[model samples]
Target: MKLLKSKWNFACLLVSVIWLASVNAVALDARKVEVRGLFKNAAILQVNGQQRMLKVGQTSPEGIKLIAADSKQAEIEIDGKRTVLSLSKKIAATFSEAALGEARIPAGRNGHYFTTGMINNQSVKLLVDTGASSIALNSIVAKQLGIDYLTSPRYVGVATASGTTRGYRVTLREVTVGGITLNNVIAVVTEGEFPRDILLGNTFLSELDMKVESGVLILQAKY
Candidate 1:
């Protein structure tokens, strides 16, 4: 009995250590990076938690080099690994490590953009809507996602396709797209037809760097 207990304790300790290491890896994705906002003849980049402004031929302290940048995407070389980073898309933490960073989605034939997204860990189909002020979800989708809008703060008016309507603004605990995850995102939930598809609005889109190319919409995160 004593021997069995000792072995069990050791196994538990090993599992805990592995779990912690995994968590640390996710939190400290040192190689993962995204483009923030941009400017003419230059780009603002978020790398390793530091903000950097680089021209077409600039490099960061952590060894991120801006090979080229346009309205569509920024090409960066990290640790000798080169990747085309779309605005708001996160690429590998360490360049040349693996094609592990960044998320890419081709546009549909409809000429509109769409991608799979996650809200509070629930899978959702998101339609990219640049004109939208913020991410909007209908009450039905909110309930399906297990969001409690009744408990949210006082409602506010939101301008929709139909007209102005009342909506509840709440901070989403977590939102994930193409493996890039952001937390504490403010979203609006209104009554009616919003359940068909979640709108990917600027509330989250503004935080990412975005560009269009060859019928593709790319989004990259700054960090």
Candidate 2:
């Protein structure tokens, strides 16, 4: 009975040591993960300085799994902990925190700064327009985004290059540009598709600090 008891204690000690080593290994791997690029249903990751491209539902050799991805961000699972990563900025903490976010938009071929952003959880192309008083979109685009502007009680007139047209003022639930997000943003929906792209106007831009560097537009949330 004494010999059997000794064997049991040794086995328990060995198991505890192995479990501790496994936990340490996971922590080390988590520290090495860096998001390099983001795409629809895919992400480029750098683990321990080695780059790896992982599509949705794929896992890297280092045990990092890409859960979901889009131009804005990537969702990854490492060591059973899920985290969202972004290409625009490196955040030390999870996005659930009210930590400020920054985004860099490089100039396009037309010498205009454009980016893919989220409006009400849906992806949309955005054009930075400082002259616009409020976030503006065409009635067609608004309908595709499920915005019921026709029923909105706030009716207004919007001036277009052609002439003055009907418009509806509404509040957006959320608008996210890169890592910066704002809630309850006022916007205008014009009756016709004059502005080719969604105008990211002053209503959203006013809340952020904007600067131009090397033809790149950097938008950082003030709060």
Candidate 3:
């Protein structure tokens, strides 16, 4: 698969733009806090095996207050201290929390902002594309992620560097990069291999505040 910069008719409008970008992984204390699931402005947290759903700014009976949340992680305040937590992982020691709702990506060796992130809890490489209207990937990548794209009801034609091709429109359960995450993201899966890199389109970027400084791409949650 070769890199191509072209417009997409379905959900992507990728243009010829380069961003020089990078994320530090964070771990939380598992015994005290365990994130069961994450969603927009809300999270399912299990404190001592008692699961409770908490919305932003709402405190649970266990004294855990949801501050901010995305598909990747949830920020909760306990005892007047805030820390982010992700899915089940045994963090034997306490870890530092990232900036509230913020993530930074540094450019790769190719001068493009490439980062490793999760699509439906499966890890994949992402190439940031502001021009694209929605996240885009090829069928191969979709299959690798266990996405049943062929069963989708929505099918559309997408414009790519090669030409227009058949694609499927689907909603991703979660898309995450660093500390920033979003859910129900729109994406297109093309039939053939073209977009060698998974294009992190506006469907995800529009939900965040983005800016570039000193060749680093910064993304922060809008909420």
Which parts of model 1 have CA positions greater than 4 angstroms off?
1-101, 161-163
* Per-residue alpha-carbon lDDT of candidate 2 for residues 153-181, written as tens digits (9 for 90 to 100): 98888888999999899999999776577
The better candidate by TM-score, 1 or 3, is 3
Top candidate on lDDT is 2
How far residue 125's Cα lies from its native spot in candidate 1, in Å, is 0.3
Say what the RMSD of model 1 is.
13.0
lDDT of 3 by residue, 130-192 (tens): 888889999999999998899999999898789999999999998877666788999999988
Error of model 1, residue 180, in angstroms: 0.9
The TM-scores of all predictions, comma-separated, are 0.53, 0.60, 0.56
**Candidate 3: where are CA atoms >4 Å away?**
1-97
In candidate 1, what are the lDDT values of residues 1-223, reduced to their tens digit? 9999999999999999999999998776566576753333445567776556565676776678888875556788876888886666343221111111233445778878876656886556788888878888998889889999879877898776788878998889988665356899988999877436798898988888776656556677766
Report how far residue 102 has shifted in candidate 2, in Å.
Answer: 0.8
